[model samples]
Target: MKLTCIAVDDEPLALGLVCSFIEQTPFLELKGRSSSAVEALKLLNDEVIDVIFLDIQMPDLNGIELARVLDARASKPRIVFTTAYNQFALEGYKVDALDYLLKPFNYEEFLRAAQKALNYKELINKPAVAEAKSEDEYLFIKVEYQLVRVALSDILYIEGLKDYVKIWLASAPKPLLSLTSLKALEERLPARRFMRVHRSFIVSLDQINSVTRNTLHIGDINISVGEQYKDAFNGFISKWN
Candidate 1:
């Protein structure tokens, strides 16, 4: 998933460095850069930012105060504070900042902080995502600009492409296509009902017809079990029998 980010710092050099680092990161998209926390708020209002690279010591409005204001919002971006002081670390955590980056930090340090923010974003968003509905035993997935609902029981398997996934359903003649990564979808699936048999395939455990050696049969179709996933598949089969 690509996370939208903005860098906020009083120092031109510091903000420039962070902006450069953010641009180089594959999964991060730099939305804007701000010289102060007040300016960052204006940008936040205009765009849906996923993460903020904020500096704690700013004039007019400090990063800590800005974070508190953001926390009150219904939909708030995750904060990663970049400050020279180590004393504010405790206060940063109290406000639920994702990470604290001490000044003089290298690209590696900045990258680590950014990654933490990315992870925190994913964790917070998973429950809010429109992927699962346990009460109805169905999920609504975005397919070609439309939200399509598919019954859990009707799902045969899911095939992962590089940037998209094909959802194979028992009743549908054609598989449904959606723009989402396999790892993202897998996290939303019910562990008891589905299993990742290969890097490219996630099969419905209830829909499996049989298994022979390294291949699993779903109706007449055969899917090879990945070496890395073999142990988990074997454990699943053992429990089933």
Candidate 2:
């Protein structure tokens, strides 16, 4: 299937080049092009865009902010960030971008990024098999530039540090670090298997060694329950008592 996209960049030349690349690509269909993030948001709302060829550094809203806005929506396009700077690449992971184009990149690099978006579309669009598991047993999180697949059963707990999170696992001594928000990961995790007992911690229900009035023990790690999430934790506690 052809993945529909909108080219977004503040520079006229950059915009034209991306639009041109979109047109040349066999599987990508260019639905629109915008020089501003605000205008791009409007166009995105009006159409069912599959992907966005977005430039990260822009005037006004900027690409990263625009990506977060779209992330809030029920349906949002996969982002392929286009930027001249390597420094801003990590920010792209916070929004779960599919791929990114480093500036002064050749058509080959752009085509590779487009192909990645198309593969993602195909994966999501594939029809579910009758025997397909109802719940996902694993999660693939973006770690820097690569997607790291972690098994749900292996995760002991998670630690949040605003823009990044650390996944503590049973298999490894070191925790896996990823560029994403705790709230974002919380939404994706299975409710029955995981719970956010603290603002900074999410514990695997099966991995809990013990729970007390304010603290939870997972192995030797003592995680304090946050006041904001007390009621939910209490509900889980009540299930056992």
Candidate 3:
């Protein structure tokens, strides 16, 4: 996912340098550049900023003061203090700053701070899945920016990608993609109906068409059972015999 950011520094050279660093990073998008904390607040009010690369020493309302204002807000952007003075580093963390970059930092330092922001963003904003009812007949899967409801019975299998998963269904040819973890989905699923056969896959027990040596045929595809899960799967199969 891409994070929208803004640089707030009083010095022209510092502001330009930070902006340039943001532009150079592939996953980071530079939305605005402000010369002072007041200007940064104006931009923040007008736009949705994901992270702020802020300098602590500005006239009138300084970066520390600006950070205090943002910290109180319900949906404030993450802050990364960038200043020549190192004394404010302790204060910066009190506001939960993602990272602290001293002035005259190189591209490596900038990228590391940006990467930390990205991790924080993903951790807090990843799509959440929740059961729709007490009966567990249906559930909501957050896809992109919207929550999509799908029947539990309709789920044939689930294939997990990194930080995301694809839900194969009996009703649709294409799988439903969602930004969530396999482990998270597994916890929400009914233990009796859904079973984790592999680290990357969870299958609907009732949807299985057939079972081979170490694989299952569900819908029109075959999924191999993971080595760690073989004994449990075998024990589950023994119930049928």
Please identify model 3 stretches exceeding 4 Å from their true place: 130-241
Pull out the clashing pairs in model 1: none
lDDT of each: 0.88, 0.88, 0.86
**Best by lDDT, which number?**
2
**Tens digit of lDDT per residue, candidate 2, span 1-65?**
89999999999999999999999999989999999999998898899999999998899999999
Candidate 3: Cα lDDT at 194? 92
Give the candidate number with the greatest TM-score: 2
Estimate, for each residue in 106-172, the C-alpha lDDT of model 1 and write its tens digit. Answer: 9998888777767655644676444233424877675642346688899999999987799999998
Positional deviation of 134 in candidate 1, in angstroms?
Answer: 12
- Model 1 regions lying over 4 Å from their true place: 127-241
Q: Provide the clashing-pair count of each candidate structure.
A: 0, 0, 0
> How many clashes (backbone atoms < 3 Å, residues ≥3 apart in a chain or on different chains) does model 2 have?
0
What is the descending TM-score order? 2, 3, 1
Clashing pairs in 2: none
Worst 10 residues of 1 by lDDT: 127-136
Give the RMSD in angstroms, all C-alphas superposed, for model 3. Answer: 11.8
TM-score of each: 0.53, 0.67, 0.54
